[model samples]
Every structure is written in structure tokens, then in C-alpha cells.
Target: MFNKTPFKGTSRTSSGYSYDDDQFASKVFGEIARKDWQDYRNTFMPVHEIFKTAVMSDDLTKQQLDRIPGNIDAQFKQSQAQASAINERMGLSNLNTGRTDISKGLAQVFAENSARTHGKERKMSAIAGANISPQDARVNQ
Candidate 1:
């Protein structure tokens, strides 16, 4: 004989009755929101405050400012050395022909890169020193 109870619809007495998908989903989302807010308060707030203070002071040290350019120059030097070595191994002393010179091309690229990096640095410094009204400062508020 067929079991009529198994064919019946879901019932409170069933073992799966305690599980409510909507309630479980809501509870999971609530916990996730709570954790996200806690992380923002505990982890992000301190770093943001420090950066804000630094920007408000508008006093970046020389070492910090030169760090990017110094690193870039060092990398360029290393690349030039490698290129020179390769040129020597290939029996081409300068890698320059009638039309183009590798060294000159590399120098131009370096100049362009340095110009871009310095321009960005100047822009960041200007933003730090610029003043903004309260209405424009907090767009979300």
C-alpha cells in the first residue's frame, strides 16, 4: 500500500520543518551586515584618520616624496645595464643605426615617465593644500 503521509505536503511535524529559508537568509544577511560595519569601524577608521591628519597637515617629508622617483631611476639604471650587456653579447656596441639609437630612445622614455610621475605628485600635493567648503567636502552627508 502507498504511504499517504509521505505524499502529503510539508508539515510542522516533519524533520525539515524547523528550517525556514527566508528566516535563515535574513539572519545570515543581518550577521554579514553587522560584521561589515564592525570591520569598517575597527579596521578602516584608524587608517583613514591617520591619512586625513597627514593630508590636513600638508607636510610630506623629502624621503617620502623622492621614494617613487628614486625607485624608478634605480629600475631604469638596471634595465640600461642589462640592455648594454645584451648589445655587447650580440656584437652591436651601441645598438644604434642610421635612423634610431636605443640609448636615446630609452632616455626619452625615462624622461616621459619621470614627467608623468612628478606631475601626479604635484597634483596630489595641490589637492592636500586646497580648501573645500563643508557642503562639497561631505557629499554623502
Candidate 2:
């Protein structure tokens, strides 16, 4: 049998009971929603922070790598000049050839290292530029 209880905004059951089912349900659901939101926020914030830290670390690494080629080039030039001077003073043409070969070897090594570092820099830059967020992944899904 349907109870003809008045549906007032107050917490009262249909059987004239003083129990507030509406308020209790609302409070429970509100607490659940708040807790869910808090959980989502807690999970997402750390992922965002980690992403930012990774991007910053990669940027720093790229900067350090970029300086390496210049430093190597400068050092090579200094060493080449000193070697050429020494060879001229010694009047040793064979020493000049050996120096040239060493220079070529070092140049090749530097070029390979520079290329690899540039690849890493590009990869890191792409990752940083993407600026992806955890929430974005969830939304896209």
C-alpha cells in the first residue's frame, strides 16, 4: 500500500517517522563525491609534478650536452695549435701527419657524440612541448 505521506523538505519518513532519509542520503552522497574528487586530485597532481620535473631535468641535461661540443672544439683547437708548433720546432713532418690523423679521429668522435646528443635533445624537447596531462589522457579515453 502506498503511504500518503507529505513529501516535505524536512527529514521525515513516509510512516510519520522522524528519521531523515533524504538528509542522510544527501550527506552520504556528498561525502562520497567529495572523497572521490579528493582522490582524483591527489593522484593527478603527483603525475603532473613528475612530468614537470622530468621535463626540467631533460632541459638541464640538454643544456649541458650542448656545451660539450663547444668545449671539445675549443680544446681541440688549442691542442692542435700546440701540436703544430711543437712539430714545426722539431722539424718533424711525420709528427704533423700523426697529428692530422689524431685530429681527424677526434673530430669523428666528437661528431658522433654531438649527433647522439642532438637526437636526445630533440626527443626531450618534443616531450616538453607536448605538455600532456594525466587528466587529458583520462578525458581522451
Which candidate has the highest lDDT of all?
Answer: 2
Q: How does model 1 fare in lDDT? A: 0.56
Mind giving the per-residue lDDT tens digits that candidate 1 earns over 1-141?
A: 854355457533322332335365566667789989999999999976754554444233333444555555676678678988999999888753443345555655666566456445654664786543433222112
Q: Which residue runs of candidate 2 sit more than 4 Å off their true CA positions? A: 1-56, 93-95, 98-141
Q: What are the candidates' C-alpha RMSDs?
A: 15.0, 10.6
- In model 1, the runs with Cα more than 4 Å from the true position are 1-51, 60-63, 96-141
Q: What is the lDDT of residue 41 in candidate 2?
A: 88
TM-score of each: 0.31, 0.33
Error of 2 at 52 (Å): 7.1
